[model samples]
Target: MNYEGAVYRPPSEARSLIIQVTIGCSHNKCTFCYMYKNKQFRVRKIEDIKNDLDESRIQYREVKRIFLADGDALALKTDKLKEILEYIKLIFPECERVGIYTSPQNILRKSVDDLVLLSSLGLGIAYLGLESGSDTVLENVKKGVTSSDMIEAGKKVVKAGIKLSIMVISGLGGRELWKKHAVESARILNEIKPNYIGLLTLLVEPETEMFKQIQAGEFQLLKAKEVLLETKELLNRLTVDGCTFRSNHASNYLNLAGELNEDKERLLKQIDDALSWKFGTKDEMYRRL
Candidate 1:
């Protein structure tokens, strides 16, 4: 496959065959992200993508799942996306599902009918980064969209019958706006009620703007204990009916996984145990970007 710099996908797509449909994130200005900093944003040529699919057919016997990479594959026009999906169905007849990372901008750009068409073409899932739902936090991080915009984008995806997986950063707002981050994030999730929710702890990467801010003391990263407290508060306010929640990323101090509403109490107790030192937390040395 012709992969570009630092392709990223949701953890659940670990087993899927990854193809680079786009070169980098369309909105790569998020202060906290450096994943696609080395590359310029552009869609891969259709012929090149088709060639990769052909090559994959020769390599794998039966590809069950495919994940389009790098960030913002859905930003491509609907006609182009439909062509790719149609070609995938032809080439990988055994493929059961296809997924991609989508930005709120892309979601809003595409009409609901466009999203529904993509879903019907076997575009099974979309991973969205809701970093923090507080407008203050979002502006601080340069997320490029408001909380209401993200909620609307998510709602459209869910309405289109696409499985939506939304992710939020644990310590995004830091100490200054942590409370607002937690509550507003919970409110957005409650409104979207995505199929899956992922919580990844904030870890600033060197050379990123966020790292510079932290060094200057403009931002205050939450301590491990504080992250637990923030998470507890967020979970307490979360009211999604059947969302599956996960916080098992390497960056997270504590690993948590459960279904919402039913498992809310159990998940909260786990956080409480961690906060009280009754459970173990991941060591700082082992954490990664």
Candidate 2:
């Protein structure tokens, strides 16, 4: 299959067939994100996408899932998205689900009826980055949406019967506002009650605004212990039921996964056990590695 630029999909969609329905992220201005900085955002043409699907149909014997790439494929018009989903149904009858990354703006702009329509057409799950629930932190990081907007967008997807996987960064607010960040993020998550919660620790890579901020002393990234504390606070405040929580990303200092409400106590204990280890201070232990 033909491809353009770097492709990214949710870690859960690693085994799924990936097609670039759009190139780059439509909103590529988040200060902490460098994912789509190298490319311009543009929607791929319908026929070109169909051709790629046609090619993939011959190359693979069976495909259980397909993920639309890159960034926000939900930015496409409803009719166009419906067409693509319809074609996917026509060509890959055995495919179980289709997933895409979506921005809060895209979700908010599309009415629930539109999302419901898309869901009926095979758009199964959506990945949204709710970097922080603190509007101040969201503004500081240039995430381009308010916490309320993020909550509304997340709920919109859920109300439409689409599986929502929301990602929240552990240290997004830095040391200054970490507590506010944790509490507000948990509150927002409880309000939305997404099907999945993905916890990621912030990684300030080169060539991003965040790196410049750190150089200029405008941001203070959290230490390992602080991150664990923030995670615990966020976890303690969460009351959502039947949601899968995962923090297994490579960027995370501690990888965790479990169902919420039921596994909350066990997960907290796991963090406490790590905290109680007599080897050394949490920061020092991590630093020695």
The C-alpha lDDT values of all candidates are: 0.92, 0.92
Candidate 1 clash pair list = none
Mark the regions of model 2 whose C-alpha exceeds 4 Å error after superposition: 278-289
lDDT of 1 by residue, 1-289 (tens): 6576777888999999999989999999999898998989999999999999999999999999999998889999999999999999998999999999999999999999999999999999999999998999999899999999999999999999999999999999999999999999999999999999999999899969999999999999988888889999999999998889999997888889999989999999987776666433446423421
Candidate 2 matches the true fold with a TM-score of 0.97
TM-score of 1: 0.96
Worst 10 residues of 1 by lDDT: 280-289
Give the poorly placed runs of model 1, Cα more than 4 Å off.
278-289
lDDT tens per residue, model 2, 143-245: 8899999989999999999999999999999999999999999999999999999999999899999999999999999888788889999999999999999
- lDDT (Cα, 0-100) at 224 in candidate 2: 83
TM-scores, one per candidate: 0.96, 0.97
